[model samples]
Target: MPTPATSMNEFLVSLLRVPAVAARDVDDEGRTLVSNDVTGSSQLHEVGPDGTWRRLTDLDGVAAGRYLPGRRAVIVQHDAGGNERGQLSLIDMSEDAGPDVLPPLSPLVHDPAFVHRLAGVRQDRVLYLTNRRNGVDFDLVSRELGTGVETVLYDGGGYVGEVEASPDGHWVVLTRPNAPANSMQLLLVSTLDGQVEELTAWAEHTHQSTPSWLPDSSGFVVSSNAGREFTAVVRFDLDSRAWTSLVADDEHDLVGWVSPSGEHLLVATNDDGAVGVAVHPLDGAGDPRPIDVPPGGCAALNRHPDPVWSASGRALALTFSSPVEPLYAVRYDLASGSLSALRTPGAPAFPPGLVQPESHRVPTPDGEQIPTFVFRPADGGDGSVVLVVHGGPESQSLRQWNPIVAGLVAQGHTVLVPNVRGSTGYGRRWYSLDDVRLRLDSVADLAALHDWLPSLGLDPDRAALYGGSYGGYMVLAGLAFQPARWAAGVDIVGIASLVTFLENTSDYRRSHREREYGSLAADREFLHEASPLTRVEAMRAPLFVIHGANDPRVPLSEAEQIVAALTDRGVPCELRVYADEGHGLAKKANQLDAYPAALAFLAHHLAKGDGVTGTVTNIKEDTE
Candidate 1:
């Protein structure tokens, strides 16, 4: 047999952010599309309806590009400084031409307070939010494509997010952030007069949210946890002050765009963690008709607006993905309930010899049944396994794409991700079971998986634990709380000391942390008891920590404090901090850099074969 030129290192290159569908026009424009690959490095790949793909841009780090309305050109965001800061660029698709780097609306050197998400385009202008106005805070701004003159809009000091413009271009709707849970407030901003008006007051105990306006502009639709166990969509009667729930799911409901025809509503749901998209009538109690895309595990469903509507109100294009599947854009014909793949993921496919996941129920310490997903090597000849504890002790492990998991699996590691106690989609009781005093319950659920793994013939001694954010905190806690369970631990931006994490977080995040972990000042004893940093000496496994210097949620201090304590005790621990990252790695290059380092660490400490024989190297530097 011809030797496979692909090494374990090269097997994971495709796992990085390879583009599936690029710069797609609202409608098929002569079948013109843009996509990319790993080595091509984010350059636009033009695809035709016939499946022929060609590169349209050679620029390095072409962040994002989409078709411009009323024009034959494609507007793109480009990384000018090679430091992950992007500038707007234009690509004329009318001719077979590459992109042109337009003048930036802001300086390339200044770092953004957070990742920038693009709102819809105005007349030849792009509206975005940046920290230019408040320095420490963000503000809405508009930059004209004709002249590149940036105009600052509302000062986003107060809680403001998800900027949406109303129909007829008359008003702008934004979600205003209030302390505690995110309370949605609808604000109408006049484009002609520049006057702002408050449309609604803070709904009490109501998780506030405002969706897009109906095509008739009769009223705006908002989704919230009101009068329901899970989130539901409601139409707020602007004149009557009445709210009506249009649709509701048992535990998780996500409302997408209202059909342009004003007849149907598309909803994505987390029904016991099996996610799928559903279509329902505007006003009815009938069961919603569901369109099966991918398995809901770790998947996010998004419906596009202004569907082609070849069959009146039924057919449409949608995007879907889970942890196991990469993002894929597909055309769904509601009439036949059939899905056709419009775009497929390039390179970095799932590890070649990994088995498609098999789901099972594991019994938690408290006798609660937890759902678990296991992805093993195809041969199972490799006895080593990795238990990936998900973040959001409140968040469940659904089907989703995780480059880190893919990388380790490429090297013959069986990856197991579990939805423990406190995870959503299970039920209200299971989720709240891990709150505050019950938080240790999540660790117990992991323990159940540890005991259950050996029955599958995998070696427990070769198994390790890895997670980021809340998952990261679990890594340390798993070692501290149950030191004998894991061989090694990789902590990515995880919490070490619950008390310090809450006390030192940004004012914005500090307000929310109280709800999840309890108040640091009021619950000092509980905080100390739950903290991994306070019990670092109990950790016996080799440890690795990666943090973003600019992370505001779990600050760099979280990484520093734990590393300092472990090092002071002469424990084997390694830490890496990136200067320009935040809560998560934003830059694709940075992720590419970090994934390999993590894989090598796991292999060094946990892999049982030749992989552990000096294949892993640790490099550490002083961030201070």
Candidate 2:
């Protein structure tokens, strides 16, 4: 028989068995095209109205897919070993199509050397973005499904995203990042003449959501934070080239998508971590008519399929992620106003004792109230806490499906999920706090949270830091810069050195990252001082690092250097490298291995042992 701790650990780790379903595209007959991890990796799956669930692809790694026009054939997007070099392919799903595991992927856009992003599938054509022409800048291209004729919609670009195509087939909107940091440039290109129309001045530096085009192609409905504090729904006219407000929220950001019938708008509000969804008429929404969800908080926008509505416009599909629940997809019927979960391989009736994270605003040293979520076990926390930071420095740690946070709470460990200084969703002002030379300011924000941890009954001395990508960098920074604050850390594909990362990262990413992290030519010294690797000698905490071998963004070298240096200094360090992964653990098999090991490692270091709770001091060596 295992000890109580061991049994609890095993049960928490078993939570990984909960399949995460991301339902995106819906066919004409109301069938949903989804990607789920039930088969150990994210693969294409279809959920029908009659309760029929079918897996479409059986690959060694993750895959993306969409239901084409008539469902005769489906577009498949796949890549090998977590390399971001995914290609677009087509699989026949018609009645005449013979069955052969995935129906044999017919090469649609097969260039292994370059990266291709599938824009979307329309009735007549498929649009995508590829850098195959120059290998640096992405060019928007569309291929006619019937004629198989390819046309370049726009060639002038850098970071030109391949996004949704217009319903009228005349225009396809392409996006690119512009200067001043955290803003975008949208270019509407004419499919026939290759003419382009730019929307918004890049100098505005305001973020915008997906432009939901009207069926008549007259204009688009989108949410933007231009000339305002919070993002609100506004319409952009193609004729007048002006924006007219449809809906405005005084406090929170609201994103709206026009329904398929073009009569209603599906609007969702980002109220801190909780999402409130409602439906408004296209003519003009008065008071929001709430579309009821599970109550805690609906999942973020990206969780659902684009457009977020059924082909008939009578139903909306969404994924719900709450502190007490693992992610599950739900379908909302507008006519009946009923919300139900989409059927999958296995859906569990989770126990009631699961903890719900409380939103706490921890005051930073500079008096900035950092938004943090405190998940304390209902039976009183074990005193061992883990401070979990999010990646993106641009992204927010929303109240959503986080298996790690859920597992940590299950194992009786207090988890602090903080949307530190640079996280989005708060406002534009909050996200730019750590930009350029002020990067370390965000790192200092973590120390404040650590010092304030004890007030919540969490043992500050017996705490660990955990994050991935940018958050991974934060984990390393907390250990290196505030050596006396953190007891242990787990870094997953994090940036080790700011200078080297900007230099060696993917070419397409370098310029984009430079906007926020400062340019190599301009601020090399500041970047070096800001890197966790620069203060490696100051690190004294035991660390566990996980990285995907094929990670294109942060790369494997970042993990190797920190692991090698820390271990060379005789400090306790554990490294797990997945040969078939990228930036983060995409495959369930790899996640099962890395996530469990990380939990165990943190648990051991944070266990209530005498003398283990002492603060970590810098490891000083006299090289004479």
Candidate 3:
């Protein structure tokens, strides 16, 4: 048993101890290769059929690991610190040798200056996307595993998203996102001639992704929001260019993967914020059947380089978690439709009966409904509230495991996580609602959330805004734009100025971010107006800003400038900079330090009332 004063930190430590399967792939022998954080940082791990786990790589930042086509070797992607400029290394799993830098067959293919993303692995050939030739956009390239000979497949500009090679090795499917709008186009490229054909025509404000070729190679299946309000799994015929809706719903956006045999498809739908899994037959003769997944957020691991189905097409692997549980890797049997845990990692069972969030629809001033998850203290009626806004204005606030939310609730604070307009789980129209100049409407949605706090028996004046990345930007916007609302704010790796962020971010990410935040060159004035820095003089809340010095997505300057401005005005502000981290805090030690400081800051500010003001006290800088 623990008191409220120490339970938050204890819970934070326990949550950090629970390891998560970041990326997973299956070998022919049925062994599951996973990337997890069992040893402080995310590293490669191999799980046997008997549920035994073995460490593979001890690298600092192993983002993901995938078994090669032959299964004897595994290719792992890692970056220095959290910089995002990743490099792929080949590890001979059989020999238990250290990872070796994949020798480049063509000097042009492996340039140290650019980031290399493993697209797909075929028989003795590797397909990847890189921005080596052009600093801005990625071009698809293929290389021979043995000779390292490389050839450019698609040299087109724009952001090249996920790429999948056909089972028969004749064709490759790739997605190119047209940013600022949610529109993306899929391309079907022939391996023999390097010719590319547009599978989905340019439709304004539409999104298409996660393409898998049919076993016969005559067509492919993809998740598309093309003329529909929500994304649906649709099949496209290469010859006739005919599109057929395979699995669709009026409410949920469907995402799925077709089995290698092409007889069945495993689809996951974004039903509000929770994920639901179902298996559908491709013959179209029967209704789709639902698979019983534990009540939580479920993600299909079928998109990995390895086969989704076991060698016998009997079992499939997936990762799942809930508000109380951390992430786990499980295998689902097709015959009995039963899920067996492969790897269940996370904090020990939360002393049963912890706070379970309830879903609510908070109505905005414009009458648009915003879906939110509210976590109340077990004893009930905590006047203090924390609004946790999610990043990726395009992403949703799902009912997933969050340490901060759990910690806040344990300490008798009510927590609200909202998915405002421009969030994806809602339909396509809802996703595009916060694009470009209309971005502030999402901020208004936050203000609406603050206004609704009182109805839940929580004090609006005692509330704080907390978030990271884009969500961090929202926190600043809420504090500055809605000055009188919050008592304090915690912005972790958030962007303060959209213009500076777009200008200073990685070249490959600029255009895509510009699509979401508006281009610096074109929308300069409008972007400046929307920036949190522009309204620094209006901030009434005490602020705690955290950032990674190596953050490539949202540069350190964003935090520095805002903190400097707030401090210059004689406002209460604290700044924490982690030297070895990029974007968000990935290291456990860093998180332990940062999260505790954040919780303490919120507790201190919320207790003093919204009118309390003080001078800048402490600024801490940490390095690995």
lDDT of 3 by residue, 493-569 (tens): 99898888898888888888888878788899999999999999998688999999889899999999999898888
CA shift of 58, model 3, Å:
0.8
In model 3, where do residues sit more than 4 Å from their true spots? Answer: 96-111, 287-289, 300-307, 310-312, 344-351, 608-611
Using lDDT, rank the candidates from best to worst: 2, 3, 1
Native RMSD of candidate 1 (Å): 5.5
lDDT of 1 by residue, 227-271 (tens): 566767777665685778787767565545566556777766766
Pitting candidate 1 against candidate 3, the one with the higher TM-score is 3
Mind sharing the TM-score for model 1? 0.77
- Name the lDDT of candidate 2: 0.79
Per-residue lDDT of 282 in model 1: 75
Q: Provide the global lDDT of candidate 1 against the true structure.
A: 0.63
TM-scores for candidates 1 onward, in order = 0.77, 0.94, 0.94
